[model samples]
Target: MTIRRLPQQVADAIAAGEVVERPASALKELIENALDAGSGRLGIEVRGAGRTLIRVVDDGAGIPAEELELAFQRHATSKVRSLADLEAISSLGFRGEALASLAAVADVECRSRGRRIRLLAGEVVESAAAVPVPGTVLEVRDLFANTPARLRFLKSDATELAACLKVVQAYSLLYPEVRFEYTNEGRVGLRTLGRGDATAAAAAVLGTAVAAELLPVEGEGIRGLTSQPRLHRGSRDSLLLAVNRRPIASRALGYAVEECYLGQLERGRYPIAVLELTVPPGELDVNVHPAKREVRFRDERVVFGRLQRAIRAALNGSQPYRMAEALSSAGSAWRTPQVHSAPAFAGLESVVAEAFPAAPGAEGPLRPLGQVQDAYLVAESGEGIVLVDQHAAHERVLYNRFLAQLRAGAGASQALLLPETVELEPAQTAAASDHRDWLAALGFELEEFGPQTVKLRAAPLATPAARAREALSELLQTLAHSLPQAALANAAASLACHSAVRFGDRLEPVEQRRLLEELEQAEESITCPHGRPTRLLLDWSQLKRHFRRNY
Candidate 1:
């Protein structure tokens, strides 16, 4: 076959693939254009998860009547002029491919300054006079309609809508002065005051309670709101980053923020941060990615170090993280304990024996010696010494038991002495409502208390009161922002992780022995549900070699 150039329609469709990967991506591009057009107030409406409709109305400079048609042409943008201008591009959008991209894959209509233009798959379908509007009113319908393969790849409506809402939330925080009202299926998902206060915007985006606990960050070139060490989430979704008011996703930046929280948060947990950095445009490169959601800095090391120290300084100036606060935050019972001596060895041995009423052959091979740093359980075995991760072992046991209960449809639920109320984020609220029945199967009895709030009357058997609350919160967060296809297993694992004995929990001799027996009975005891090892066995030979006792 001879070499040939692709048709214009085909080329435009291919180009649109990069910019409009999903409903969320399209929304992001539209928002950036509106922001660049000097919009102070924006209204976003979505239906059918942005597949059927996505209407963005902005109170910005509207396109001229004659230029409305030109705006839909490929490579048409007002943000940049020449190649030299790309080096100092301060606007969020410069490529000018958003309109053309939308017109390629979706039916796009734009009404500005009494002129309306419509396109179907990059072809001009309609151009006529319309009602005058204050700013640009752009509507994208039937997204991916022309691309059947792309439409087939979209996720569930709940998942897609959540992604769209997340994009809006990020922008709301990135530009607090821009008032935003977001509606999904006629229900208001978010509304920000946009008074130019980051904390106030945070209150509107991330719940008022969370906003109230955020600490002010004042770095040399970094500023925003960050959560106290006690306030954290199961995922890094809450870590928002913006350089010069342009929101970009950077795992390195996220790590820089989290490094400052080293030894401050538990494993598998991250803090809520909204960091905005002031970097000169000349030192930043935003044209690397087609979507402009990624960028490169001249010196990532300098930025990383500066961000880390600034966050550290902000954290240091605040009161040190309190042990009680950390414990109380997770619903664990971490209070002053009454001092007591260890029970008699014989009594504990008898209790352990009774608890594990199995055949003599089923007895655990390891013998509990004591604990280390009130964390690890040290035990003696025929070969040598074994150090058991008490938490991991307990997690393994609980996960198996929970999975069995779920499969058997007989999950044991314990009634709480006092009902607890939990207020969730917008996405979590939607997730809880969507997966209410699944949560019930996981031994949670929740009632709708109010908007974004739930009343918990019961939890999984043996789960502590506060711990159950924490588990529910984490589960909802995971369900909302994580792998929905594998949610059931993840839910069980989350429950197990929360209900298991904490690392710092001091277990009595009998308790340790009983745990060991149960672990032995578990079908899989080598690793916990999350794949962490439960025990580390140091054989006699290895120990002797380390001690220079080869003989």
Candidate 2:
């Protein structure tokens, strides 16, 4: 086969695909252009998750009448005119491909100054006069309309809308000086004051209650907000990182931040952080990707070390964490598993047989000897020695109970003596509003107290009152991204995880015994809801082999 040049239309479509993978990507490009144009205030509106329309109005320098048509031409740019200009680019959009690429696949209308131009599939369809305005108003309608296959790949309205909101949230945090008003389907979802206050911006995006718990992080050239050790999320989605006010994805840098919280957070938990680093433009390359959401640094090690030290210093200066109190408070609602046993172990053999049906003639039930390190239960079983992760076992037990309650629609709720108010992040608020009925079925009695704020009058029976906020936050994080098919299971798991007994919680002898009895009867006791092993077995033969005493 011989290689031939591709058609211009095909090439344009391919280029547009690279730049505008989704509605969110298109919005990102437009917002960056607006920011680079020195827009102090931005108004963003979207309909049908940006599939029907995306309107952006900014108060910035308007385009000249003659340049209006040129703006839609490929490779046309005002930010870069020379090799030197391209080498150390600081502007968010300098490639000059945003407008052209967007126009290739969608109908675009641009109005700025005293000029107006409209394009259909990258071809001029209309060019007429419009009302003079100081800034620009760009309306993108029928996105991916020309590319039928691309339009079919878009996600559901809720997921796509969440992605759009996420893009806005990132910019809001990065540019606190620029006020942002985001409207979705004619409803204002988020608004931030542009007074240049980072905390206030964070509150608008991450919710006031969450922002209040963040500790200030200040270093030589790094600054932002970070959560306390006790305040963590189920995923790293909330770990917002930017370089020189440009939001980019860097897993290495994210890991460097997480490294500072080693041992402080649980294995699967990560801190909620908004860290911005000021780096010299000459030392970074932002042209790696078509969307420019990724960048390469000249000295990754230096950045990593500085980031770790700065965040670590901030965490060190915060108030001391009370481990015992926290553990106790988290387990305040935990009750000993109600398992009936015959007097003097009369029917223990049947329980053992049920637990290990494969091991015939197995010794009776396990005898809870004691706890090791206050985290694991050491029990003597017929197989030999068994070490149980106390927390994981309890989590397994509660997961089964919560899942059953969710399925049966009979979840027992524990009412709080006094209603407590909680605020969630904007994205979380959207998720909560959509899944309010499901949350209620999971035993969360919530009332809308304010925007992104809810009053918790009751919680799941297993969830302690002190941990109501944490439980809701974890569930919301899971629900925000989980698919419809898996939402209920994930919510049940989140509820179980928050309500279960925590590691390091000292258990009394009776409690430990009751826990073992419950585990013996659990539907699935080998692993917890998150797939972590709940118990480990050490057979007598292996122990004898290790000791070299095979008799």
Candidate 3:
């Protein structure tokens, strides 16, 4: 067959395949267009998961009446006049194929009031159109209508709607000054008025729970906040990336974020973070993909170095917030609280009862030595006196029990008689929708109300109601960008910790006895879930050496 030019409609449809994967892709394109057009406020409305109808309204400088027809024409763009301009391209939507491709498979109506001309331009181009408006109003109906195969692959309405919100949220974080509002299925979802600070914007979108743990990051010309190492979830779902005010999913950046948290967090745990880098347009390539998700930096090392340093700074600056509580009563009678708080027991009966509850097949009964200090319970065995960290042992026992329950699929759920409704930013709502099943498995039943709200029906009864709500919000926010299974597990562990007894919580004699008994029956009562040592052992010889008695 002779080589001939492909038909325009065929070519446009083919191009659409690259940029328009689903309703969310089209929404992303339109959002970028709006941002490039200098919109400060944008509103999105979707019906039938953006398949039947999708509309984006922006208060940006609109297109001219005369150029309205040309806007949808293939390869026509105001972003570039020559091929050389590609090297220094800075605009978000520059390819000019977005509208043309969208028009091929859907009924697209674009109305624009030119930046120079205030009047609306009305025209029924090859795609679709009705009356025009003052600014830019793009309405796409019957998406993939022309292409039955593409429509066949479309997901459920809820899923697609969530995807669209995710796209919008990505842009929202990049452009802190741009206010965004989203409505889906006749319900108001997310409404974020532009705030100058990205952290403030993230809090508005991700929720205060996640925002609270985020340490402010600033260093090496890169600035952002990273979640504390202890708060790490199991995945990268919480990582958000932006380059010069544009959200791009660069793998290099993702690695950089992970590298920054190395050694600070446990092996399987990953931190939640939003990293924004400012590089010269000439030093980066934003036109790497049709979807514009990836970018190539001229100096990847610099980018990586900056990212690592910034995160390290943030983590080092902020420490976990601990609540003040009353000390043990025994400590008050001592000359100093520190001395009495040391690992020592007052009574041999208490020590023997707490540390060595009759071991199976033991030859003889064990005797207890007096407390080493207030911290450790010292017991006399044939070998020597064994010192035990009571607090660490209890933590290990609790952690093991929780892990066993989780592994056995017997994790308990305590239902709230009254359901709690949380108002989420668009991104968080999307994130929640994506992980609804995971959350359910962890004993949370949640339903999406709109683009910005979730209805939480049931939660674990043992968990505090307020902490549950906060944990859910934070987990969703952190996992918005990257949702890996490991991240989910870490998040679940955090939730468990919130409900578990703290280190300093005063235990009654009966409570302490019960806890120790339970610990004796638990497997792996030596380390916490996060790998922190649960139990510490010190012998009499070591103690005597510290006091110069052995010497």
The Cα local distance difference test for each model comes to: 0.81, 0.81, 0.66
- Give the C-alpha lDDT of model 3: 0.66
TM, every model: 0.61, 0.61, 0.59
Q: Write candidate 1's Cα lDDT for 125-146 as tens digits.
A: 9999999989999999999999
Q: Worst 10-residue stretch by lDDT in candidate 1?
A: 327-336
Q: Judge candidate 2 at residue 265 and give its lDDT.
A: 59
Q: What does candidate 3's lDDT look like per residue over 1-551, in tens digits? A: 99999986677788889989999999988988998988899999999899988889998888887787788777889999887898878888788888877877788777776322111111244433445555698888888887889999999887787788777777766677899888887777766779667766676666554566568888866877677554556656567788876777878778878866543454666666777888888899988988888889898988888888787677656543221111212111101113222244344443333232222112122244444344554445443444445555554554454455556555667787788888887787777776666666567778777777888888765566766777677667666755474554455455555665554455555655565556546553333445443332333443454455755
